[model samples]
Target chain A: MVVTQTNHLAGTEALLERGRDLSTPLLRAVVDRLAPPMDTVAAYHFGWIDAQGRPARSDGGKAVRPALALISAEAAGAPPQAGVPGAVAVELVHNFSLLHDDLMDGDEQRRHRDTVWKVHGPAQAILVGDALFALANEVLLELGTADAGRATRRLTVATRKLIDGQAQDMSFEGRERVTVEECLEMEGNKTGALLACACSIGAVLGGADDATADALETYGYHLGLAFQAVDDLLGIWGEPAETGKQTWSDLRQRKKSLPVCAALAAGGPASEKLAAMLAADAKDGDGEHPGAHEDFSEREFATRAALIEEAGGREWTAREARRQYATALAALDGPEGRAMPESVRAQLTELADFVVERRR
Target chain B: MVVTQTNHLAGTEALLERGRDLSTPLLRAVVDRLAPPMDTVAAYHFGWIDAQGRPARSDGGKAVRPALALISAEAAGAPPQAGVPGAVAVELVHNFSLLHDDLMDGDEQRRHRDTVWKVHGPAQAILVGDALFALANEVLLELGTADAGRATRRLTVATRKLIDGQAQDMSFEGRERVTVEECLEMEGNKTGALLACACSIGAVLGGADDATADALETYGYHLGLAFQAVDDLLGIWGEPAETGKQTWSDLRQRKKSLPVCAALAAGGPASEKLAAMLAADAKDGDGEHPGAHEDFSEREFATRAALIEEAGGREWTAREARRQYATALAALDGPEGRAMPESVRAQLTELADFVVERRR
Candidate 1:
């Protein structure tokens, strides 16, 4: 799954850059008046220094959701700047879910640092999440465009899907096993829905027709599934140095990743291996086996990863993602592309590749 | 303190009944659509029945916030139907707070049974809370005839306040002491903000003039403060049998309630007694004298309650509550009580009395 890097992100990077720019200014402006203390927590969660308002370099994530939104708008033939507000809205919504997810998952770390819940405590973390959700709506409302209300409705609908997805994820926590179809359905809601919303919203904001917006939505949906598949691959198989964490991390957590599930269903050496690993991990509460799985050389997990590849899971998912990206590009064709200008559309195309191929 | 219970909810109860009639159909409609498993949890939380959805004759509290909203709408000259959405909206918001509060506070019991978190577990309890929050917004959006965008904005604003209040409350935890002014500010954000929002939103939905809406908001503001004071009093001095909980429970928890702080500040015999109790409790926590405060006895706590009255804390707070209730009623300004012809407004007034006058 190794791929060469390209430097054609000028347009996509701009979209990502624009997204990062919009969130803080608009959020600060709103909370500065309504609820000043919230800005402290919001700033912190956004990876801005401390609650003390110190300036610090922070690694904001890929901003994939916001990128999809802006790129969709440009692809739908609207000026790139036209989708700025919607981009900000989608990004805020994404961060909102991340905040709550940390609390519910009881994950102590995120983005290579203490999670919002761990540092500030759960109550504050929950409030910060709520505040971000509110601010997303507020930003949409204040966009001052004619479609602001429509954009809000879209955002709200997408958020509901995200919440539903979170519920489904939580429901699986104590379950013995989950079907592949059910897993796909959960990913559709948790991951795909937001990505779809990003593109659909961008199209709508850019004055794209209903049919075109729907096409872009379909594209984003497929892209999301593939993105998660690759993410699952990296969770266990990616380079330790490149991924900035540890190899086989997901396996250690018994996270039922796509590869693990595929291997479990293989009914051979992989299945036997997975069954034994599951039993060992099932004794999770006592914490008696801290690092026990990692003690078993990565060879077995690597073999399992190879089995996932042989099962064609990674290639199948990647093909689906590419299909979606192509469909999105196709939807941007004809008179609409003429309106957006060729240079802009080219930039957005590169952004689509960025979405599906990123290592991190 | 020994007054009869007659006419306690004279005004508020009528308004509550009318509100119930208007909102039940819509709420029931939504409840019926909830996923079976989630619905089971929600039903239990709503006091419907023990997970089986049987008809339980449980009292679902006073429904004070919704009643105030309806009464304010009527007082501002809107029809009963006009206030119905606001009624349901306020009630849902209240319940959302309760769901999360139970989890954050680690309260094991509520409404004479296990709390929602206790029954459903923390993760599911969180999901339920999220579901309620989303439903509240969804319901607001479903009001076809209402100004959906405006309604959404108003609701979001109110929700932001609620979150801010929760943040402030959490901030108070583990703090040694705080000033009365800070306490009042926190109470306003936590307890008063939503109540005020209820009245203000009802007025907006009912087509009330800005001036009238502002007055109704003021009414609710004062009313909420009064209600909290009375509740604080009940936590200390109310009978355990009547209150349906242990007497002086707040004191046992070492909660920084208004009466406790007031008595401590007076620096007299009552203050001295409170200091001794607090020191003993602190010692117990340090393992210096295990359960030292447990030996103080409930009778001594009752005597401490007498000291609160001597410090003028109870009387001062009660007077404040009465004044707020009077202000809310005065805002109506109906000729011989003719403005609010519906029973709903009357019930709301009774509910206000319940807030300030409840022995519990």
Candidate 2:
């Protein structure tokens, strides 16, 4: 929000980089163990290499999720590396979903690069996703701790929920009306489940008691909701320079994101106008035409965004994001949360604020 | 084989039915526990229910893999039901791969029913496959046995290889030539690895020592090779009633099956002629046309099979099948196999013979 707040959140990226530095080598080794073709596709997908298999520098990710895992482990009384397996497992599962998501959504670009399916084809994408999924399980099983089985159970349950959410999200695209409650439930499954596991798994590996683990998971769950709420905001309103994509990407795609769902549920003139505009787009302006979603002009997108805001979607989403962030912070201060170190708690709180307050 | 041998192997279906009777309810329970919509797709895919979510009788596969699991566990001294979890896990994995394989290959039918992707769409198919995969791990983890992690690890490794095999299979389709060695490697990865794991995982869950597990896995591995060889034979020659698909499915699709590879590797005039026909199919026929693979006439497929047979491919594959069967039998009788009960040993021998000798 302000210069001081921005500076306070500067450590987020640093923490992420620390996590990448800790985990990437092991992740690389495990992925490289796949069959040669799969390994090549995986490396390419991870941004570790170009399509030719030459070394290439890629952001991989912000490592935000892995940081949560490691920080949760530390909060649970183990060093960050003790959470490495959990970190790797979650990261692999994330990529697995991304690979499939790219294919399913027909997304051509992600993180400023061609999507894996775009580069390697959908068949390769599917198999590579499957391999990554299997590898995630393998890595977790090899944790060699007494809690390894329980941790694995945690990951699998989370994965199922993630897939469930994606399935619902896809199904939503086909429906004329999707309730706000359904949208939130889908978001929780798609986003919250993995984030929740990202913490609880670390807690398990770090030998935390159930109460402490539950507190950390609650923190992550709410943080995930906050993150998705903010992401929905950014998808419609953020500029390309900041969000790393075209303007109004979600509106153009007619994605039933949180803000749009809220606005539609508001059921006023703005909502009616927005629905009519989208319906007309689907009727004549290439919305229903395959590959035509990207054809929306700048003026058309601006109108759509204006409709959502006028429908009260923007205000509702912003409020929900803040509410979720507060819930996350409160989760960290709950009775069982005392198990978390003060430093860890502060870092998590700042991360929650950073997620909701991010400009990109 | 005589009537006596036929009578001996008739119990194979009975064994499969018994295995199905033991594992289906538990398997259904595990699958139905997945989130809504996903549970629906999974139930339909497994033939546990109809697309409408109503209970409907459907062929739930031959249950051969589950029978292998339970029988291997029993041979290692556990009761049949003690292996139910292992059976369920392997069966889930089998269906998982089948779902993805059907999608990847774009097959419209499986087990005389519309394939999951064909009916539910590929996106749903992919997610359901993932859910099943995650469910397999969850079921295995819930076993809470000392060997649970190890068994999960075994399943993960098998899954990875199975994906590798499928990747290789897909890649081979675009190639001009595929060696028999490459074909076998793909077969081993795609088919043999999981079958091997089926036996070994059962052994593990049954508390069998590593030697016993290894012996059983070896038997299944060879049996897998033998099974694939016979399957390749049936793909070219078996009647539609026996295989439950259209005639000449593999040849029409230009699949680089084992027998075709063997024939191509023969390097005779017949091999040259067969190659020429395939090359022409690629050039002149719809081979180059996406979705044109289905345009092949029955007469054309007959000619392709005739060319493969004339090239000595059929004879070579049949001989290889018998050889692999014998090797599998030998594996069952090896010193390491001494831990297997006599009755179990005899049944396994009959199964291997039946794999190679069955007309289908």
Best by TM-score: 2
**Chain B, per-candidate TM-score:** 0.82, 0.95
How high is the CA lDDT of each candidate model?
Answer: 0.66, 0.82
Least accurate stretch of 10 residues (summed lDDT) in model 1 chain A? Answer: A284-293
Name the docking class for model 2.
Answer: medium
Give the C-alpha miss distance for residue B271 in model 1, angstroms: 3.6
Instruction: Give the local distance difference test score of model 2.
Output: 0.82
The top-ranked prediction according to lDDT is: 2
TM-score of chain A of each: 0.81, 0.94
lDDT of 1 by residue, A1-360 (tens): 222345655656776777656544654565454354567777777777764578766776777777667667776677656677777788777888888887876665566666787777776666677777777777776554546666676667667778877767656544546666676677777887888788778778777776766666666666677677677767777776566546766665556556655555556664665556565556643322223355556786666566656655455555555655566566556444445557656665666677767677
Tens-place lDDT per residue, model 1, B162-189, is 7777666555444445555666677676
Model 2 RMSD in angstroms: 2.5
> What is the Cα-based lDDT of residue B172 in candidate 2?
72
